[model samples]
Target: MTNQSNNSVKKTVLVTGAAGFIGFHLAKKLLSEGHSVIGLDNINDYYDINLKYARLLELGIEKNEAETYNNLCNSKTHNSFSFIKMNIEDREALPILFKNQDIHIVCNLAAQAGVRYSIENPEAYVDSNVTGFLNILECCRHHNIKHLVYASSSSVYGLNKKIPFSTDDNVDNPISLYAATKKSNELMAHTYSHLFKIPTTGLRFFTVYGPWGRPDMALFLFTDAISKNKPIKVFNNGQMERDFTYVDDIVEGVTRIINKETAERIQSNKFYKIYNIGNNNSVKLLDFIKEIEINMGKEAEKLMLPMQPGDVERTWANVDDLIKDYDYRPNTSIKNGVKNFVQWYNKYYNS
Candidate 1:
């Protein structure tokens, strides 16, 4: 029999924020890969609690059973999936979770997401993104965790005019508090990786959109308004740009990163790395709306507006590194991506 210090070769993976848009997709992919997954989410009322519960239901996790603390719902689809209703900020609870589970890989996806919201409720961002992530990193270091991958946002690329935002670009000048915190997370992760010799990968995700996406994002918001025959706010007077990567593509890129573990310790300076997971295609905001108009069979009543304070004029990604190392392929075109999202929205809401 073979034995090692890491304990059972981490047959199970622990994913935080299993109920969130990206987190839900990530957990689903992990389960599909035949990995025993332990997912955690407090199911906060950040957006609609109903949507969060609905996602849990799709994973074959009973919403009723999630009523308890650390509620675990076995995945009917994968049988290896389990869930917990614990908050990421709960320091006491996390240590218990790490100690109890044979979690080899840790994906920290829990955070109070939203740039505009971060400006209003800075405390929420600090608690979840900073404090919560700290606990996750500490747990990983203490438990001899093999690899830790966490979500960092493209919002971290705030105030930068660099074309196709790359990992080599300087990201210290974040315009919004949300962006600042996200950039801080990258720095924090780097510190832990260097100091603890833990391999960490941070993904600077572009404007990710698709089925079960956040209502606040442009694709979801625009689709919802247009389908209801309502006016859609065209920010920057419809002169903005975004790299709207599809949800499935993002999941595929992330899944590959998980299994292909980093050999160099973050301290190796070579071990710690960041990648921009996005479609190289940057669609103009107006073109994106047009795609929606065509897809939904309704022309949006446009309300032209200047860019929001925390918003940037454009965001493009240079995914050369991602392709070179991981062959990260983001294949969903905006038209198809929007079409898929609208389909899910209509079916889910019975619109």
Candidate 2:
């Protein structure tokens, strides 16, 4: 890590899944803060490849250059930001990239996301989330990376009736393959931390939403359906509840964890830590939709439906640990968050 100022250290950070929703935001934030960021993503067609490409465009990597696999494309917008078209599961390529890049820290955000999709494509989950994560761990172990910050999901609290999910909660009984994989990540991170003494922090994010959000998430889907006069599926008869954290808040928590000295926070010889990053307040599903309706100036034709398979009823994260350690809590209200997304959505689609 190179000292940029008395208060900040500039690091060469490897941000995998850089084309993904949260990863894109984190990479941009890191670059703005004077860090050298290497953004990597396979650009898999899990959703819209164009959206991923558009995100890369925001980072100044042209679509033509971004499409080339195993090649590093320097950003035209930010000199400190570079992107590579690669998969973390590529055991051969990942190590070489690490060796060549001299990455001081790694924030592994690449994973096969979507809970329901995991059921339809179980093998995809194993390949990306399990095998791919193992490759990242191996690279970190060999390269002596200063810190590893990985994304964990709120779905890991599967089947737990607890209102506010805590890091101390028993997450052994995961309902979905997606949840199982995220739980597996936490366990894997713990093992690496314990064995190799790698300082690893896993952030279990809850219902992240805002600009450049995933098209599959409820906010994006609902906003799209409502705008198009299509019926939005209200699962569990709109009885769901979520923490509904904003993207900016999630990025803030991640950057703080990344910049903080790993040794200062870890316990005696224990280099593993996990924190739930959320809004710290759960909002009712119907109310959340109403906020979207207000922002979009259109009401959604909701198709009240039964709960889908592999879906949990509610998720409320206990972010006390994050507040205690970083003196930060996700404060973005759903009202403002929804409005921001709607504004971005209208502008993005209109343009």
Candidate maximizing lDDT: 2
The sequence of per-residue lDDT tens digits that candidate 2 reaches over residues 105-220 is: 99999999999999899999999999999999999999999999999999998878978899999999988999999999999999999899999999998999999999999999
Candidate 1, run of 10 with poorest lDDT: 1-10
Check candidate 1 and list the clashing pairs. Answer: none
The deviation in Å at residue 153 for candidate 1 is: 1.2
Instruction: Give the Å error, residue 173, model 1.
Output: 0.5
At residue 151, what lDDT does model 1 achieve?
91
Q: Give RMSD to native, each candidate.
A: 4.6, 2.9
- Tens-place lDDT per residue, model 1, 203-282, is 99899999999988888888889878789998889889998899899888887878775663443557578999898878
Which pairs clash in the backbone of model 2?
Answer: none
Model 2, position 285: C-alpha lDDT score: 98
Displacement of residue 264 (Cα, Å) in model 1 is 5.3
TM, every model: 0.93, 0.96
Worst window of 10 by summed lDDT in candidate 2 = 69-78
